[model samples]
Target: MPEKVTVSVTDEAVGRIDEVVAALEHGGMHVDQVLRPIGLITGSIDTQRVQALGDVAGVAAVERQRTVQLPPPDSDVQ
Candidate 1:
């Protein structure tokens, strides 16, 4: 299964996140969403592509997006 990840771009590459996304798209990766100001790109990438995505010039970090379960509303710990 492909994993969803949030990619952070380098300060110098902030405005060029699209270029990174374009490169990934050429490899059949999906570019779901992007935040230009923060240089964040969210996409669903195959395991094999994860490394390659990070290797893109503008990309600083690529971290897998994960879900965390929360306690029930009635739980004691606040």
Candidate 2:
């Protein structure tokens, strides 16, 4: 299954985010957003390819996106 992930670019690579995005795509990442100001790239990729994303140049870290579910406003679990 494809899992969403947030890729953090290294400080030194902030200016070259575009290149990093290209490399990530080449590595099987289906990019959704490129937050240039924060040097973060959000996207989804096969679980198997996550490790490869970490190896891409300029990538500081690769973290899986976590999902949180909430009950309705009137729910007892509130």
Candidate 3:
């Protein structure tokens, strides 16, 4: 399964986000969004490939995306 992830670009790499994105893609990431101002790249990749993303030159961190589900407004659990 493809796991969604958030890749944080190193401070030194923020100016070269495009290159970072390219490297990530080369590392098997399916690019989704490039939040340049924040130096973050969001994407999905095979779970096994996630560790490879962290080894990319410009990557400072790679974290799997997590989701939180909430019940309806009327639900007892708030």
Candidate 4:
């Protein structure tokens, strides 16, 4: 199944990140958020096709998004 992922771009490649985002969106991929200040992007894409993003000019890393579960406040675990 397709899943959410976070994409980070190299500092030197900042200008081209937007172009990559546009191309992904144009290809029917869902781009949920664009964090330009940190050069990051969050979105959902087909797991099988994730490697395609690596081929984009500026992408430094692609990571799968995972949710963290925190214990209730009263729990002993810290």
Q: Against the true structure, whose lDDT is highest? A: 2
- Please name the candidate that would achieve the greatest TM-score relative to the true structure: 2
lDDT of 2 by residue, 1-78 (tens): 999999999999999999999999999999999999999999999998898999999999999999998888998983
How much RMSD separates candidate 4 from the native structure? 2.9
> What lDDT score belongs to each candidate, Candidate 1 first?
0.82, 0.97, 0.94, 0.82
Q: What is the lDDT of residue 6 in candidate 1?
A: 87
Clashing pairs in 2: none
Residue-by-residue lDDT tens digits, candidate 1, 43-73: 8978777777777778789898888999999
Stretches of candidate 3 exceeding 4 Å from the true structure:
71-78
In order of listing, the candidates' clash counts read 0, 0, 0, 0
CA RMSD of each candidate after superposition: 2.6, 1.5, 1.6, 2.9
For each candidate, what TM-score against the reference?
Answer: 0.78, 0.89, 0.88, 0.74
Off by over 4 Å in 1: 70-78
List model 4 lDDT by residue over 1-78, tens digit each: 787888888888787778878877765458999998889988998888787877666779888888899999999997
